[model samples]
Target: MQETLACFKAYDVRGQVPEQLNEDIVRRIGRAYAEAIRPGNVVVGHDIRLTSESLKQALIDGLREQGVDVTDIGLCGTEEIYFATAHLGVGGGIVVTASHNPKDYNGLKFVREASKPISGDSGLREIQHLAERNVFEATAKRGGYQTADLLGDYVAHLLSYVDITSLKPLRIVCNAGNGGAGRVIDALEPHLPFTFITQNHEADGHFPNGVPNPLLVENRSPTTALLQSSNADFGIAWDGDFDRCFFFDAAGNFIEGYYIVGLLAGAFIEKNGPQRVVHDPRLTWNTIAVVEGAGGEAVQSKTGHAFIKEKMREADAIYGGEMSAHHYFRDFAYCDSGMIPWLLVAELMAQRNQSLAEMIAARAAMFPCSGEINRKVEDPRALMRAVEAYYAQGCTHIAHVDGLSIEFDDWRFNLRSSNTEPVVRLNVETRGDVEKMKQKTEELLRFIDG
Candidate 1:
């Protein structure tokens, strides 16, 4: 109990197991969640983490004891709980997962009705307070529990995003990083025409292939190498909870997620009507141009799933995409799905008769960018101010949606401090000049490191 349960983060709860997080702490959190939300029924699921089972059990124990009926979907990704929560008309849901953190770490993510996230600004803080208090009223009656299989319905929902039969039989590389995504891929295999060349395709809680985060350049190696060796069409890699997915093209080149935002925006705009598309401000010129060019309205929102989901719901947007590889769908109750983006991309390739590389190359050339660069600093806020002040001399445009985005003659960059880390994130892009983009990025890096 001495360990600071600083486990509750800005977006979700994540901490080292048994110390900051354990069965006892999770039990309180579960009870606190039930007490705060007061749902009659709730859905729960867990990822392939070592402590996930015990943590999930503890959470269920608290909920059941508090007279909240629990429907458990064992050993699944985060999105499955989201789907089941909204689809089943449950009061709320919780998924026990660390989501790409180190093996020694574990956490929980919760959602209210319709699978909407219960972020700190919403309800997570109240739950955290109640849990930290460590006191709860005992319920006289205990609720029932049941195990439900949602794989079939979830798979059908995924397949419904595109015309599966019309998709070409392309050999694609898939690296699940030994996370919970492998099973879902296996389930979808029989229904698709394409052949999957899978790697680390097992449910190993130990994370034998390292943490299942493709965002790290090191983690991209397995998929990139396999894509080249197998001569596959394209490849994808997912994080532990399988909520964020990254992509590699035919030549095994890692595709910056910024471009994928534009790609996904186009597909959603063309398929669903000319509707609002929410985008984060880190790297938005590409997304805005692509969305508006396709007759869809592009709206800017602060980064993070909770913010993006709230904006999408308010705008009634058909789709919302973050340059960080999170894509949200209105049909999915405004929740981000790691599975839908790839499916839509595959279908777009088939319908447009264009290779993944070729289709995106033109857009990439138009908006050459420095994919989010992070820097550790003694004082991140001071660094952001210094960087912004130095660059604002002759800036043509500026925005402060998520951070500081300043534009000049032909280049623009955003420098923002991380909410969770003592680091500053920088993103620079030029209007078609790679050299200019590189120069600006280097200059900004010097300022950030100073």
Candidate 2:
């Protein structure tokens, strides 16, 4: 009997190193992926994690054994694999990255042709099943492997989204948190007119400071402190793989990702004129208002990269943004990038001659929100149902796109259970009513805990 693999998740592979994810398992994954997807050629890259390189080599060996040509772009962020896959016209792409997970953990993210995500709904389940069975027919031909440096092209593609000449000489703070973003920043520095103050910028798998996760409030201290001390116009922080980026205002205020979503939606509309903007259903008021106000259509999708990307393709949206700081661009193969967002926001600041805080103030005030709060509960589904039963009568609108989202005339909230844990996440917002938003949040928490 074969030992079952536990690293496979709903959308990707993630688990603790050595125990759940070892070289052998990754090698099996490569063979399974090749057999299931049957890609003639694949782009493979790895993050700065200590184990990533070895795991990637094992994966390459398995793929090459199965006659799958490999294009290795070493030591890259997750977005680079997406870019290389679409840019090189490869059959598939895989990036070995855990993206903000603890140092003991690692994972892999995958994309197929055109840089489309490979989630459970797509081919991830099949890949996981095949890997578990650990059976592959021997191939006569061994696939060739080659190394390519596409950094120049990838940087060029990122710069194409903004007007280089229009960027102002603003001072900015960039905190890479010892992740993979610093390399890309170094490459982009020469092309822009901004002065950057970098902290924990080097790629260190040991994570000298901590895991490169900006979502946690505690993890944001370094970036905020640096922004204030340096007197920079704004601050930006990225996750381990740099696929998601969070922002801070000149005042050292961490701006919520929801408002950035609105800002980008409006910017895209102003630039391209009435294009569809896809957004997650978790926080809808601000995004919907901004999109429609700019004469663009706002299409709501279930939260997650796979769903958002699929919705973007279906609507041919110019851009899509999730409150989690994942911004997707149509030009970037409908894939999310941490770099493109700041570049575009910088251009907007330059063009409007306004600070990031000034631009976001009105929208944020108009739609005050309580950022996501997570709670560990015995039955997340039951809690959500009880909350829904209590509020359903008063809510003017209800949606089940990703979870339970109930909307009243002036206030709304979304409650969803985590896919991999026994935790439920809650988000609340009120139209121009901070007190109401706070009150509703407290009420919900009390009820949820009760």
Candidate 3:
């Protein structure tokens, strides 16, 4: 029998549960992964989603059938799987998570040795095709399965990224949105000097407050409200799997992820001295300026974790950041992490004797950006082409790195269509001209709508 795996996305497997992604389909995927990559030992973990456990077990069954040993790091965030894959020297790893998707959706993210991503052009396509064919050779010996607790080691590693003694006794607000991040926070609380005001700190699969996506404006209210009322230094929030983290200042303002990228880039250069940093093309001006000013090289890559990580390795970049809140570290085998960014930011604040707002305000003012605006169109490709044609004149530069990025002397914009939907995403920035940035954003939207 053959099946069409609609859950297989360009980067990983994601779909609505039970229908598009169920235990049977996941089992087939596991067998396919084992056959395609032929990893002898694999690490697996799951998020707080209700169906993740069962699906993980089904996947393990498939791996075992193909004689692949499994190490179940039960109930962990996606980064933990990445860490364990590289730390424990496993052949590969997978995490069962939908990562801020709605209640009924679940998925899997895969990585090969050294925590390298297995995306479309990588081994993912082969796995998808093999799973669709649904044929696997039976092995004489079944693989072993065991559980490991690497929390202490993981937390220690997280702490290694920052100088703990340099961190001040700052009060920070952390909202996990009832996801896996809170667990890691709890583990790190005893080790750090800062006081953590935690919200929705428990791991709840039901997600009563809603899906744990900090990108949604509504999801941020709880964290921002708590931060303002409690007089905390700053606030941080995470999505379901806690892979990407969002930041809020003491004034209860959501710091745009673009500025954070520049901040992190500068932090890396300040610490490591003129190293390369990777950034997505969606928003580039501020990052380039910050990197060059700090005597570092700024490298641009297509907007995705796989691409960023691959580019980081090629350039031996010390750090990589995307405006979507994903922060990648070279020390972590070039994988993205939600926990590391906040810690580094805290250390940066302490070292500079500044607040989070104080550090970001200068850069945000220098590069005012129209945070990614999305519009659904009947044909996103056509809309992209139309936007490109409309803006081609008076543009000093144009590139289709990940999308249609058009640049002028004082302002620039990147317009790209979504991979999975008929929606186009637009991002605009200017050379410290907020009004111009706003005007151009509105103009681009009107054109896109037309």
lDDT, each prediction? 0.91, 0.95, 0.94
lDDT of 1 by residue, 118-229 (tens): 9989999888888888777789889889999999999999999999778998898988999999999999999999899999999899988798988888778778889889
State which candidate, 1 or 2, has the greater TM-score: 2
Q: State TM-scores per candidate.
A: 0.98, 0.99, 0.99
Ranking of candidates on lDDT, top first = 2, 3, 1
After superposing candidate 1 on the true structure, give the runs of residues whose Cα lies further than 4 Å from its correct spot.
1-4
Better of 2 and 3 by lDDT: 2
- Candidate 2 Cα outliers beyond 4 Å, as residue runs: none
Q: What is the alpha-carbon lDDT for the whole of candidate 3?
A: 0.94
Backbone clashes for every candidate come to 0, 0, 0
Backbone clash total, candidate 3: 0
| Candidate 2 backbone clash number | 0
